[model samples]
Target chain A: MASIYIDNWHIVLAALAIFITGALSLLMQLGLAKSIFIAATRMIVQLALVTLVLAWVFEQDSVWVVLMLLLLMGGFATYEIRARQKLAFTGLWSLGLGGIPMVGVGIMVLTFTLTTVIGPEPWYAPRYAIPLFGMLLGNSLTAVALALDQITRGAKQRQGEVNDRLALGMSRTEAMLPIVRDAMATGLLPIINSMAAAGVVSIPGMMTGQILAGADPANAVRYQIMITFAIAGTTGITLLLATWLAVMRLTDNRHRLRLDRLRSQKYPA
Target chain B: MLIIKNLTILPINVERLELKGGVTALAAPSGAGKSRLFAAIADLVVNEGEVSLDDVNRNDIAATEWRKRVRYVSAEPSWWGNTAQDHLSDDEKTRQMAVRFGLTTELFERPIEQLSTGERQRFGLLRALVDEPRVLLLDEPTAALDQDTSLKIEAELVRLAGEGRIIFIISHSEAQIERIATRVVNIIGGKLREGKK
Candidate 1:
């Protein structure tokens, strides 16, 4: 059985549904009607642009092209992670602390999955590689960003406690261990919640998308399981790496809390 | 001796000072940078010039190592864990010190959040003594204690100093200073001067 395709007119019909929802929101004075319309328009334009770029890349089927695209995705993920942080290291340290660890984890996990687990006809096939890379990069990016932000803010808020520990003869790493652990827990919460509620509470986006695209239910479920595991593994490793690197940057070799490196003053309450 | 040479601790300057092995009470009015000077000596804050313990320069030793030898207990001590026992070392000396400070073993088991400011201050002093530091930089260690408890703590600190351990204490009470301090210095206009004995 073939799955029904969504043509232009169908997409237009979906827009009409969104417009009706927006109109109702406006009538009810929800105050979110304008935001909804703006967000919807942005999504349409961005996705349309992505579709065109993806089509071009798919046609090339070159390894270099695929690799470049993957790098671009990782770069943007790194940028977004840095941008989201409340307290960040100065200059290139900010970029490299989160960026290097995330990209390193992304490349390692994606390579392992594509080469060993899936093993498509062309190992560098954009169709499989790009989407998989995107999923891993995007999820890990959020995790790393959250972890960095939490740990940085945690260190700032607990500066006195940390200094007291240091005065008690604890090393910098020893003093910050609890903060790092807390940050890791904070970073992995979303993934943990999703994993707990995967099938029963809600169908995951990947699984639902695959099933909608004519894939067999069983096959789609299996793929979803693999991707979920991959995401969990990637996020854990990336968050740990990011937190460690960030903490190292925040402290000096002499075990002093160098909160001076942070650019922002909005500390945790 | 704890020596300070031309130490410029931003808004406070010490041309030269030698703190021998005894309680050298630092007395100054409020906002006189007494704690700031102590922080400088402990390397908790940045300062220009030199600080040396005996003949070894602070720069010659690692910061962590320096802090271990020259421990600073703040006015309002910070505790991290739920139990006071968690912050203390498991040793006979620590237990004896706790007992001497009127901190019952039962108090150690109780949550730190339940501890009053006075109890926390006692625990803070105990925590600092755990490392057996050669130089103790205490900022108002007995500020929250009652008269009897303050005198007891002062006697213990004087005893520690008599054992050749250097101690710098920031105290507001001249009577307490007279009771415990071997020498006294007054901080005025960001500088140190000899005070009444």
Candidate 2:
């Protein structure tokens, strides 16, 4: 193993700058200083706890430990997605339906296509598996949650217009497709932005860390590209599934919106 | 008939109201809780109240079924769908309804963000009626339109009510109430009183 010498203080100072700048922007734009503080605190505590847990898992060096950690990450992501959207139990089921498949396929690609491995054992190497799985699941969770949120809200808001289409004898899916497509694009913008900014504007954290640990620049670039591609694939599939599942569940067999399911009571009487 | 009895809403408190509907216009000054009363009867508001359609209690019916019986349109229609066309069904019946609301082929192809306010309001009202709901609740439906468009919307509402669908309109316009309202209900100081019965 190569000795990794990260200047902890330097990282802390940079992270502080990022956090303060983010908080200032939120305060100015959204008037949400308190919310920014709460969210930043959440990010800090969660990441810190995950770091400690990861240290233990890495040291134990067991396949089971890696599996457990990965599962925990996925579960946390699921909970966060549902909570952030204020989704009901229906959302819970759809998150699993949408998220788990992407995670599975990502794991398969990483283990079999990217490296020479099959089954749970060889795939559990913490140095490789943890970061890759974390990256995939984290991106998938955001994409799925965003798609679900936008589509569900869209379906309800456009209920009338949708019903007019339905009255025109449009199929349920047909009535919903345009909005679903739009929501899918909104969910995808983040990944696209990340890809666009990866090399020219900013060196990605993963690539920078790898280079700092003395990996060849070419090898680090190659890994970064592969990981980025995988994340994009995972996020795209998850967005499609999440939007489809959410829209299907919103409508009944006849394609009418189940308005009772929406938590918002914004409709004028 | 649309029946509301002893429907008490809070925050914006409406102590009690009893009414049977026939083109009833709910007229109130701005922020006088007329909209909240409609929302309460529709069971869309979270409050302690009893509402019924015929003999069936509004709260007892499955929310979806109850919603199917009554459609509510806000002053500012919720623009939740991804595109303009997403709001309509693929069927010709719905398309015809969209045409009735003045939606053209180009409108269907355009995103909702590009739609004019008048177009969206018409679409909102048409959407409510097309579901064939027994009751319709409209909040400031013509508030944003020109005189001719407003008259067209009122005519549409009158036609629907004439077909036996109960229609309740909340309007700030006295002329609007006179034109379409069979009976006007007035709210003042948080109390419901019959106006020009």
Candidate 1 lDDT over residue span A2-99, tens digit each: 67977999988878988888999999999889999899989989999999989999999899999899888888887787788888778888788888
Name the runs in model 2 displaced over 4 angstroms.
A1-59, A63-123, A137-269, B11-21, B78-86, B89-120
Give the per-residue lDDT digits (tens) of candidate 2, residues A1-269: 48566686877876787678777878688666667677878997989998898788879988788777777777777766666564442534645655565566556655653365323445567877888887888787777767777787777667755654443345668778878987898889888998999988999988998888889989999888878888898788777766777777777664556656656422221
Second chain of candidate 1: TM-score? 0.97
Cα lDDT of model 2 overall? 0.72
Q: Report the alpha-carbon TM-score of model 2 versus the true structure.
A: 0.58
Cα deviation in Å at residue A142, candidate 1? 1.8
- lDDT of the candidates, in the order given: 0.87, 0.72
**In model 1, how large is the Cα lDDT of residue B145?**
98
Q: How far off is residue A67 in model 2, in Å?
A: 5.7
lDDT leader: 1
Worst 10 residues of 2 chain B by lDDT: B10-19
Error of 1 at A264 (Å): 1.7
Top candidate on TM-score is 1
lDDT of residue A152 for candidate 1: 90
